[model samples]
Target: MRRLLVTGGAGFIGSNFVYFWKKKCPADLVVVLDALTYAGNIANLDAMKNVPGFEFVHGDILDTKLVERIFTDQGIDTLVHFAAESHVDRSIHGPDAFVRTNVTGTLSLLNAAKAAWLDRGSGIPHRFHHVSTDEVYGTLGPDDPPFSEETPYAPNSPYAASKAGSDHLVRAFHKTYGLVTTTSNCSNNYGPFQFPEKLIPLCIANILDGKSLPVYGDGRQIRDWLYVDDHNRGIELILEKGQAGETYNIGGSNECMNIEIVRLICDLTDLRFRERASLSEKFPKALPAAGRASRELISHVRDRAGHDQRYAIDARKIKTALGYHPKESFEAGIQKTVDWYLDHENWWRALMDTLCFSKT
Candidate 1:
């Protein structure tokens, strides 16, 4: 059986990928290494706790010794790195942790991978796949085209800067030491199991609680949205077939402004609950007062510092190379995501009380 090490496997995209991988490749041995940080909740992996081929280790990627041990003892044939400090607002508050986790931690993993593979001699049959974001391309204007694999690095926020640094390290390792590495830069991802701090989840949670949905600035910042499951599929395809030392961009071709996304969620929620009330033959107390729509909950807040005006990805490379296509539309994906939050209140509620979401 092939052994794979997936870092940050307890977080949003990472966890989703792990779940998909386990089902798609049942014979593969999957080991997950996570720090269990505020954002890394073990609950995300609760369903797979007893799976035969799954293993979980609570640790930080910065721990080189632990990483090396995993690579050595597990005879890991593949590495899918998704660990990083990814929150932009948190990076703004303090960049030290970002640098440590995103920059230094990546270097640590690369060093360990190189050492382990070299010790194993020629034809190690190993591949290292790095997961990254398109924010490293910085912002784009109205007429500017989407970012591609060759886009120059122009990161803005501390979070993006740290990821950019990690991306460079991965490239250098591939060029300098002949490490078999592949990197993927993806657009924004939204779906189930996301912490309630990000834009989509935050909006859903606030609206459900009857709180004002905070929109940064005028809420006009644009981002390309890729469903989490679609992204997971793309990562799996890249890990299986992408050429070493090559970078691929993954996007959904679904671009929408922040305000547009918020409004769509509000309308979906309103319709969903309205129908629920009708079926139950009772007035829905959750609905806003008559004549008041959920859109009234929207309140524009102060803009974040160095907020990227827009982000879009030219995903032609992944599409052409791997024959990958996203299966979910933005409207369908957002409806499912909102309905997920509505049904799984206990999951997010436990996280809010335990994790430091207030800081996020």
Candidate 2:
């Protein structure tokens, strides 16, 4: 069996990818190493707790010794690194953690991978796949096309800057040391297990609780939304077929403004809840009063500092080269995501009460 070490496997995207990977390739031995930080909840991977060919390590990527030990002891021949400080607002509040986890931690992993693979020589089939975000490309104007692998680094927020630094490290390691590296810069991903701090989940959770749905600034900032499952499939494709020393851009080709996304979620929530009440004779809460649609719950707040106005990805390369196309459209994906949050309120509510997220 091929041994794979996945860092940050408890985070949203990482956890989804881990679950999908284990099911898709049952022969592969998967070991997840996560720090279990505030955002990295172990509950995300509870379903896989007893699966065969899988193991979990509660650890941080910043610890070089632990990383090296995993690589050496696990006979890890492949790496799918997803660990990073990814929240833009949190990064702004405290950039020190971002630098430590994203920049320094990435370097440590590269060094460990290089040491582990170098001794095996070039004939060995070893690879290091780095998961990244398109925020590293900074913002685009209304007329500007989507970002491609060729786009220059123009990160804006502290989170993006940290990720950009890590991307550079991956490139340098591939060029200077032949570490057999591949990187995929993806757009925003939404699905089950996403921490409630993000926009989609935050809105879903708050709307369910009858609280205000905060919208940053005018809520016109646009982002490409790729379903978490689609994003995971792209990453798996790249790992198996993408060339070494190459970067691929992954996206769903579904771009929508923040306000538009919020409205869609509101409409979906109303439909789901209204139907549920009809069948179960629950609270039977009346619809919004006149001029008070669910949209009324939207409360414009201060925009984040250095918030990117728009982010879109040019995924033509991945499409043509790898024959990859997203299976779920934005409408279908959002509905599924909304339903997941609605059905699993306890999963997210536990997180909210534990984290004590502030609406301010």
Q: Scored by CA lDDT, what does every candidate get?
A: 0.88, 0.87
Clashing pairs in 1: none
Per-residue lDDT over 1-360 for candidate 1, one digit per residue giving the tens place of the 0 to 100 score: 679999999999989989999899998999999999988989999999889999999999999999999998888989999998898988988899999999999999999999899755746788999999999999999999999988899999999999999999999999999999999999999999998888888877666666787788899999999999999889888988899999999999998999999999888877777656541222233444243578988888788899999999999999999988999998889889988887787888787665343311
C-alpha TM-scores of all predictions: 0.95, 0.95
Candidate 1 displacement at residue 145 in angstroms: 0.6
Model 2: lowest-lDDT 10 consecutive positions? 282-291
- Scanning candidate 1 in windows of ten residues, the lowest lDDT window is 278-287
Measured by TM-score, how close is model 2 to the native structure? 0.95
Q: Backbone clashes in each candidate structure, one number apiece?
A: 0, 0
